[model samples]
Target: MKYNKKAMTKLINQHRELHDELKKIKVEMGLEKNLAIKTLFHSMVADNGPYMKEYQELERMQ
Candidate 1:
């Protein structure tokens, strides 16, 4: 099977934007200070870290 690399790249970018927006909201609303909440937020951000690798590989391809 084949895929459109540009479309995939755009999708990844959109997801990253959404991620950042959510992170911003958490900060703006002061939700990151609680220990449990901060841990969760950090974990969520860590999960997104791997996507950066995938996005880089895709960008290198097309």
Candidate 2:
């Protein structure tokens, strides 16, 4: 299947935005605090799973 460049670029941009948001959340929650960081990391992972999975699938297809 042919992939649409514009759509793919948008998806990639969204992924980057999510990554940056995660970083900000981590910093805001206190990265030096192990407990809070761990909790936030888990939550972020769970929240980003779908997007990450979709990105991986698309990567494989390409």
Candidate 3:
């Protein structure tokens, strides 16, 4: 399947932005004692980081 380069670039950028925001939120919420929220955000940050990396790699290969 072929992808539009412009659209892929935009998608990668959006993913990058979301990954960054999630990291920031995780840091800002560091002092919170809510284990559930912290765990959820931690997982989200972890997942997003890898996904963004994969997306960037795919974009580069395009």
Ranking by TM-score: 2, 3, 1
lDDT (Cα, tens digit) per residue for candidate 1, span 1-62: 12334634353355765456555656777665244333333443334643445445565667
Error of 3 at 52 (Å): 18
Q: How many clashes in each candidate? A: 0, 0, 0
Which ten contiguous residues of candidate 2 have the minimum total lDDT?
1-10
Per-residue lDDT over 1-62 for candidate 3, one digit per residue giving the tens place of the 0 to 100 score: 23334434344356765446545655877644244333433443335644445545565766
Model 3, C-alpha of 62: deviation from truth (Å): 24
Q: What is the C-alpha lDDT of each candidate?
A: 0.47, 0.49, 0.47
Q: What residue pairs are clashing in model 2? A: none
Q: Which stretches of candidate 1 lie over 4 Å from their true place?
A: 1-14, 32-62
Q: Give the TM-score of candidate 2.
A: 0.32
1-62 per-residue lDDT for model 2 (tens digits): 23334434444456775556546766887664344334433443335654545544655666
Candidate 2 Cα misplacement greater than 4 A, ranges: 1-14, 32-41, 44-52, 55-62
